[model samples]
Target: MRTIVITGGTDGMGAALARHYLGAGDRVVVVGRSRAKFDALLTSATAARAEFIAADLSSVADGRRVVEHLRAGHERIDALVLAASFVRQRRHVTAEGHEASWVLFFVSKFVFVTGLAAQFGAAERPVVVNTAVPGARADAIDFDDLEMSEKFTFARSNAQQRRANELLGILAAEANPDLAYVTWGPARIVRSSFAGDVGTAMKVGAAVLGKLLGQRPDAAVRPVIGIIDAPSPGRAAFRGAKRRPLTIGAHDDKDAARLAAAVEDGR
Candidate 1:
C-alpha cells in the first residue's frame, strides 16, 4: 500500500483523506498540533495503519521538525497533502516574528517540499497536493514587506498566502520536473476551522454557506484521491476535477527564485 502524509489531518478535508487511505490499508501519518483531536480521529477510524505527529505547522521551525521526523520514520512518501491553514481576524504574528498566516499557508509548504525532497523522490509516484486556490495570483508581494507589519488587512494577507502557493508549486515542479505538484481547490467553502479565526460573523456565515453550497469532507477528498492515483506530472491546478490554467502572475523567473530563496532562508 502507499504511504500517505497529511498536514492538518486532525480535521476537515485532511482528516477525511486520512480516513479514506486508512480504510484502504495505506499507512497514514497525520501532522497537527492537537493530540486530543488525533486520538479522537484514530478512535473513530480504528486503523492500525494510522499515526500522528503533533506540531504547530504555523511555525516554520516546527514545520521543518515534522519534515525531519517524517524523513527518518518513513522510507518513502507516496502522497503528501498540504492542507494546513489558519487565519486571524486581524494581523497576528507568530513567535518567529513572521505573520502567522504567511508561515502556515506558504512557508510550511516550502519547508516540507525542500526538507523532504529525498523521501518524496524515494517513492514510485510522489505527489504533493496543496489544498489552496488555483489560478489565483497575488496582485503584488512586496519583497521588503512580506511580514505585512507596516500595513495589514485580512483580505490582503489572505491574497498573499494564496499567491505564494502558486509560486511555490511552480518552483517545486521546476526543481523536480518529474514530481507531480498540484494545487487543488473547491468551488465552495467547506465548513472548517478555517472559519474559526475569521471572527464569529464569518464563522456563522460559513456554517450557513457550508450547508448550502459546500461539499462535505468526504466529498471534497474524492477528486484528490483520484489525483493521487494518476496525477498529471509536473505542475497543475484544479478546481474540482477540472484543470485550471497555471499562471505565474506578472512575476518572472527571478521573482520565483527570490521567493523560493526567501522561504528557504527563513524570511
Candidate 2:
C-alpha cells in the first residue's frame, strides 16, 4: 500500500483525502495542530492504518519537528500531500515571528518536501502534491516585503503565498528529477471549512459562491488522486481536472531560486 503524508488532514479537503486513502487501505500519516480533530478522524476500521502528528505548522520549529518525526518513523513515503494553510483575514504574526499565512502556506511545505528528501528517494515512485492554487493569481512576489509588513491585504498575502508555491513546485521538481510535483486547485470554488474560517462578509460570499460554483471536497479531490496513482513526468499544474500549461510564471527559474534562497535563509 502507498504511504501518504497529509498536512491539515483534520478538516475540509485534507480530511476528505485522509479518509479516501484510509478507505483504500493505504498507510496514512496526518499532520495537524489539533489533537481533538485528529482523534475525530480516526474511526475503528481505519485507525490502524492512520497516524497523526500534532504540529502548529505556523512555527518554523514545529515544521522542523514534524520533518524529524516523519524521518524517524517512515522509511519510504510515496506521496507528500501538502494541504496545510490557514485563512487569516487579519494581519497576524506567528509566535515564530513570521507572518502567519506565509509560514504555513509556503515555508511549511518547503520544510516538509525538502527535509523528507531522503525518505522520498527510498520510494520507487515518489510525488509531492502541493494543494495551493498555483497560477490562480499571477501577482509577483514582493521580495522586499515577503512578510507583508507594509500593506497587508488578505488577497495580496494569499496571492504571494500561492505564487511562491508555484515557484516551489518548479524548483523542487528540477532539484529532484525522479519526483513528480503537481500543484492543483479547483477552478470551481470548494465549499470546505475554508469558507467558515474567513470573515462574516467573505463567509456569506463564499456560501453564495459555493451554492453557485463550489463543489464538495470529495468531488474536487478525484483528479489529485488520479495523478498520484499514475505518476506524471517533471512538474505540472491543474485547475480542476484540466491541466494548465506551465508556460506562465511557473518556469521562471530565477524567481524560483530566489524564493528557495529566501526560504532557506528564513525570510
Put down candidate 1 lDDT per residue, 1-267, tens digits, no spaces: 789999999888988888788877789999987888877776454557888999988888899888889988988888999987665778778788888888888888888987777787788888999987876555556788887887888777777777777777767776666689988897667756563477788778777888888888888778899999897678888888888888756655677788888886777
Question: Could you give the C-alpha RMSD of every candidate to the true structure, in order shown?
Answer: 1.8, 2.0
Which portions of model 1 miss their true places by more than 4 Å? 43-46, 193-195
| TM-score on alpha carbons, each prediction | 0.93, 0.93
Q: What root-mean-square deviation over C-alphas does model 1 reach?
A: 1.8
**Model 2 Cα RMSD, 1 decimal:** 2.0
Q: How many residue pairs clash in each candidate?
A: 0, 0
Q: Model 2, residue 55: what's the lDDT?
A: 89
lDDT of 1: 0.81
Worst 10 residues of 2 by lDDT: 190-199
- For model 2, what is the C-alpha lDDT against the true structure? 0.84
